[model samples]
Target chain A: MEPIIKVENFTFYYPDSQVPALAGINLTVQAGEFLGLTGPTGAGKTTLALALNGIIPNFQGGRMGGRVMVAGLDTAKTPCARLAGVIGSVFQDPEAQLVAEVVEDELAFGLENLAVPREEMRQRIGAALEMVGIASLRHRSLRELSGGQKQKVAIAAAVALRPRVLVLDEPTSELDPRGTLEIVALLQRLNRDYGITILLIEQKISVLAPRVPRLVCLNKGRIVADASPRQILAQEKLTTELGLEVPPVTALFRMLRRAGVYHGDLPLEVDEGQRELGRLLGSRASRA
Target chain B: MPGKSFLHKLNPLTKVVWSLAVITLAFVYQEPLPILSLWASVLAVALIGKVLREILPAIRGLIIFAAIFFLFQVFLIDEGQVVFTLVPGTGIGRITDVGLKACTMLALRMLAMTSTIPVLLATTPPKDMIVAFVEKLKVPYVYALMLVTSLRFIPTLQEELSLVIQAQRAWAYDLEGRNIIKRFLALIPLALPLLLMSVQRARTMAISMETRAFGAGPRTSLHTSTFQLLDIGVISSCLLLTAVLAVVSLR
Candidate 1:
């Protein structure tokens, strides 16, 4: 697969701070890939995410080393406004990000700033609302929306710009379980159906483990682990050392494996664990 | 506040012009009868816009202020026949017929001048107002956006203030059972957190706006405002009323 994003030995230090926010980072995201990024608080997850779209070096007055390239544009050198066409970013707080009073107007705001034609802006707004399944909310006030719905509008606003990659920085952290699920499902659909590359940042891995095929763990401003979700979750010791919350299902399967009662790969999800347990019981029944 | 009446459909600039005209006419006319008619005309516009019910509270507030103003002005002016006196031997609280008439005219003039605001606000959305300022008046979009965005966050900040108050209360901080001076001092704790949070929110909002390519180049709007026949009619009528009032007052 072609790499859409490439980070090479990138190091960043925030203004007025001696400590580096990110250090010695190297990562590559392939086209149409859904990658999960998880780390504990103060682990530079947000800094790396911001670096993807030139905000770290451009908008933020930070000293940095190395380069980040998204769709062949060097993020550090490219203007943030120009890079906005290639990378769409969604932040954690939906309330803070919204700029318009109404839903459709919110989507139109970015396009309007980009100098998109009125006709094209309208079409993109409609298509994005349809994709997010919030067509009925097109006329609703931003103040009237729930947190989940507001986040969805934020996503739709970003998606309307038709960027090649969408980077969400803990978009579900402020939402309820149902809202989290809705966002996760919407992201998967965007990645699978529209071929939009997604880099989802989270504080926990449980939600990401089942949905994302690849997982990257960050620690102390460095890339600590980069592998498949199964491979990453199976290492209970490493995950515990990293201070990541292991999903309950993955934890149970690991304990079973330790006791020599179960074998094979650990399940990352509940249904996968159920199937694994059923196969183990079947083998024992046959022996009996 | 968002409704589809004649005033609502008119261009925002037209309403702004009408508001200015009403304010000008109130200032121009000195007689009680003309000023009272001007106030009545503003109320008539509110009735036509179907916002009279919505603006009743604002009207009530204006009435209370006007009444207070009347009380103060009526006692200060001592002209014409003395109508009533309180504590008679000292002329400390004496009211005369001319003073009564003058105070009434002044109060009515104030009511006429200020009441146009609520009618204008009730008919036009803030977005439309900003757009009119940007497109027609040649105001820069960034400044207009700043004005509207600050207005938008007022309610959000108010909500945050209540949350901070509640959080402080949870810590057994008594805000209500205090003297007036203490109550004023109690707001410091609540205000500090809200101020810090607002600064943080402002930073986030700026980043969000920049990421969306705000100030990238020339921008366009989704909804464009064009002056319709109703807007022209409203504008002409406002001009005519202003001219007639000027002429009548000078005569």
Candidate 2:
């Protein structure tokens, strides 16, 4: 199948800046795939995400090299408005992203801008609210909602566009743990049930490891590691050197392996770690 | 502030037209009684809209302004019989009947013209107002959105201001000191950060709006505003009342 997103030798420099924000990047994302992009601060995660939606060079007015294509449209050439329907982009701040007074209006904003028929816009708004599990908040004011609810409204607003791909740039950074979990779960469902491709960018790997099959690590505007979460997390030295936070469970299993007590793969989640420890102790007891 | 009253149900454009008519009539009437009646009629409409109680504070503020204005105008005019003298034998603050009447008319006209605003605001939600402006008045959607969005951010900006003040206080920056000059200077620190944050927020908001295809093409609104029979009736009545009042006051 043709890739849904392709970035080739892409480099970007903000106007009047000496250093490039993104440098010599090459990546491709297949349709219906769930991928996570992680790196330390200034690792160009947001720059790359913006590039994917054509906001980097087109909207931000920066020097660019190479190309980014989404849904067969070149990012540099296509207008962000046209790309909006193909790739829904959610930003970090929930308060800033919402441009409507009410939850339903926020969802309808994109659809209305795209000039969708009123009836279809209503249906999409209703479906988006239901998909985000905020149907009860349909008529509620955006000011009355909590940060998490506001973020959900933002996501639903993007989701209402019915884009083939969703690219979120540190969406849960300003949210609480429960809010983060809710957003992650909602993304998973959207990717699984609706077959929507998702590219979630974050600073922490723990939240994305168990959920996303593919993980892309960035450092200094370059793709340092692109592999399965297990393959990436197992390289503790590489992750630590790059200033990425390895999952605590993965770190713990790595410690045991170094001490010569365990020889199995690192666990990315707590439950998996618990079962692995149980098996390790059971074997020890049986041997004694 | 959303209500199920008749005024609330009227199309926003109709109410805007009604308010404009009342303001026009307020200016046309020269007699205190006619101007006072115009002001009374605005109050009566507010009462019918069930927003009289909600608009009391705004009306109270307007009353205070009008009272001060009346005092100033009363002292400035020297025609007609003297009602009283503030400083006897010296005409520094003479109170004349003509001055009283003219001031009363002026104050009443000012009150009647300005009071329609709060009533109109109280009855119509900003969203519906924007829809009416775009759908009925042929105003560009982008300009309407800009107006509504700024209104929406007022509370947010206010909250951020308080937060900035608190943050400054945490760092030993006193904004409530007894020294007036020091207090005024303290606002410099407050204003700079708020301005910077607002600029950053505006940039983010622009990007967010663009990402959602805000200016992509000719847009459609989900909420449609049409002139109902009640709107037509109210508009016609407003025009007729203004015409009658204009002729009577002129005569």
Candidate 3:
């Protein structure tokens, strides 16, 4: 797969900060890949997400080094307006990001900024809202929306331009478990069905682990681990020391393996764990 | 508060002009009768718009303020004939008839002026108000967005403010201090966190807008406010009313 986003030896420092927020970071995301980004607080995850959308060095004035390219355009060279059509960014708080009073207008916000023709904008707004399952909320006021619906509207706003990549920074952090699951499932469908690349920044490993194939962990302004979600979660010592919350299932299997009860491979889901345990119990019963 | 009514359907710009005209005409007369009649007219408009119930709470507060203003005028100007004397000997305690009349007119004028704003705002959505400013008045989009976003966050900020107040109270802070200065000092804790939170929210909101390509170039809107026949009728009536008030005041 060709890399749509490439960051080479990137380093960035905010004004008045002693140390760089993103230090010597090198990463790449292939076209149409759903990648999960996880880390402890202040681990440069948000900084990296900002860099992808050209928000870091473009809107945020800071000392910077090295390069980030999205869809063949250098982020440093491209204005955020130009990059916006290629990379849609949904921030953490849906409330702060909403610029319109109604859902339909909110979805049309990016298209309007890009000056999409009215005919095309109407189609895109309708299609985007439908894509996010918020078509029914078209005329509803933002004040009347639930938090989950608002976040969905926010996502719809970003995707209205049909961007190739969507970068969501902690999109589910403020949501309840059901809301979080709804958003995560929607993201999964967007990636799998629509072929849109996703970079999801999340604190909950369990929520992110099942949906995304690849997981990249950042720590102290550096990429510490880059592998499949199962591989990253299997590094029990590293993840624990990095202050990441280990998925409960992954942790339980690891503890069972250490106690010498049953071991084959780590399970990331309940059904997989149940199968593994059933097999172990059967084999031990036959031996006894 | 959100409803479909004659006033609500009027173009936001027309409503704005209507309110301005009513307020300006309220100041045209120094007589109590004209001011009170204008106030009645404003109340009637509010009733027609079906926002009278919603606007009454704010109007009730202004009535108390106007009463205080009337009383202050009754004692301050002692030049006219005495209406009454509280302490027969003390000249300061005397009520003058001229003071009572002038103050009554002033109080009514103030009430009329204050009433028009609630009538305008209670019927118009803040979003539509900003949209009209941008579309009709040709205000810059950035300023209009600022106005709309600030208005949208008002309720959220209020909620956050009360949360901070509750947090301070939880810390055993003396929020109910009897001394005015001490009570004022108690607000520092509430104000500082709210300021910090607002600043942080503003920063995030800026980034969110930038990422969406806001301010990149001239923008188009999904919502376009257009002046209709009703708007023209409403605006023309306001112009006629203002002209008649000007002529009547001059005569």
Candidate 4:
């Protein structure tokens, strides 16, 4: 299948700054792919997220180089409204992304803009709310929510659009650990079950990189590492050297294997770690 | 939770229609009793709805306006028998009965005009009211939904602005300053950021609303707001009140 989004030599410079936010970056996001973007703050993670939705050239006045196409439509040519169905974007700040007071209405906002049939809109709102585990908050005001609940509602709003690719820009950074887990679980469900592509931009790779297979590391607005998590995590010097932290389990597995504790392969998730540990313990028991 | 208020149980459409009737009748009566009655009813509603708490602070703004209005009418109106002429022996001294009458009517009319609003705001959720308005009055659903969304966004923006103001003042922007002009000038410093932020919110909401196919056609109401028997009885009694007054006036 054709790539849903293609970025070729994309560079961006803010109006006030002399330096570019993104420097000649090239990337491709295909349908149904869960891609994790990792970098430190001010590393153009958000700038890259904006380019996928045509917000860079249209909303933010900035210097642009090369081409960014979303769902075969040129980001340069397609209006922001036109990109609604193709790219769903959630911002870093939940408050900035919220428009309606009520949860149901917030979910209905983008559907209303697309002029969807009213019943379908309601259905999508209901489905999205259910998907995000926020159906119980339908009547509550947006301001009444905790930061995590609000982010869930924000994600629900994006999912209601039913876009092929969903881009979340540090959606959980402002949230607590519990909130982070809730959002990551929901995102995993979306990517795994619904077959929706997800482009997640976040700094806390320990939380996200394990779930997504692909990882893109950025430094000074350039893609310094474009590889799977297993490959990327092996280069400990490159990771910490570039100010990025490797996932805890990956680091733990590397440490255990180095010390000859017992390891066949590096496990990414907790379950994977549990299974590996269970096998090692079983082998020791049998030998004894 | 359903709001606990006498007026809260009454339909918003009933309040709107009845208050409109009261407003129309307020114009015809020469007696202060009916005008006072209208004011009293509004206050009762406001009190029952717990809107009185909000009225105090929000209407600190309307006090100066009321005073200015009191002064303007106290001098400008020159009708009927004179009591205290504005000039005195020069022909404009003591206030006239007509002036006082006019002033009483004007003040009471203004008060009564806003009376229902507090009750409306205090008891009815803006979303429920908008849905009711659309369902009851045959307003196009899209427009009503837009209006509902706008009202929904209103409180969000207000809260955000108040927060921004407080945060700025906490950082020594002096938003708590009492000077009228300085406070007014202080608003200028905050307006741009608020507008920019609000616009961004609106754009996001618009997208969120559209992607679900929100306005493709006539949609079913997840909310059903119907007038209860009490609402009907209330509206009927208000209609009777207006009719009785009109009859009394004709006689």
Assess each model's interface with DockQ, reporting 2 decimals per model. Answer: 0.78, 0.81, 0.69, 0.21
Q: Give the alpha-carbon lDDT of every model.
A: 0.90, 0.91, 0.88, 0.78
What's every prediction's RMSD, in angstroms? 1.8, 1.7, 1.8, 5.6
Give the alpha carbon lDDT tens digit for every residue of A1-288 in model 1.
558999999999999889899999999998999999998888899999889978888898878999899999998888888988899999999899998899998999999999899898899999999988899999999999999999999999989989999999999999988899899999999999999999999875778888898999988898889999889888877798788888898899999989999889889889998999999999999999
lDDT of 3 by residue, A209-279 (tens): 87788999999899999999888877878888788787677788988988989568788878888888889
TM-score per model over all chains: 0.96, 0.96, 0.96, 0.75
> Can you write out model 4's per-residue Cα lDDT over B1-251, one digit (the tens) per residue?
25576677777798788778867777776677777787777777677666787776545545566667877878777677777754657775557788887787787777666666655666777767767887888888778767766766666678878888887877888765789988889888689888888787777655444433344454455456788999889889888978998888757
List clashing residue pairs in candidate 2: none
- What residue pairs clash in candidate 3, if any at all? none
TM-score of B-chain for each predicted structure, in order: 0.92, 0.92, 0.92, 0.80
lDDT of 2 by residue, A1-288 (tens): 889999999999989999988999999999999999998899899999889887877789988899899999998889889989999988898888899998989999999999999999999999999988899999999999999899889989988998999999999999888888889999999999999999999875788899899999999889999999999988878888788788888899999999999999889999999999999999999999
User: lDDT tens digits, residues B1-251, model 1?
Assistant: 35578788888899889889988888888788888988998999899889999999999999999999999889999679999998888888999999999999889988998999988888888899888999899999989999989989999999999999999999999899559999999989999999999999998888888788888899988888799987888789889979987997989
Sort by lDDT, top down from the best: 2, 1, 3, 4
- Scoring the B chain of model 3 against the true B chain gives a TM-score of 0.92
Fraction of true inter-chain Cα contacts (below 8 Å) kept per model?
A: 0.70, 0.77, 0.68, 0.23
Residue runs of model 2 more than 4 Å from their true location after superposition: B1-3, B78-91
Off by over 4 Å in 4: A9-23, A56-83, A114-122, A233-242, A245-288, B1-14, B43-68, B71-98, B128-244
Interface RMSD of each: 0.8, 0.7, 1.2, 5.0
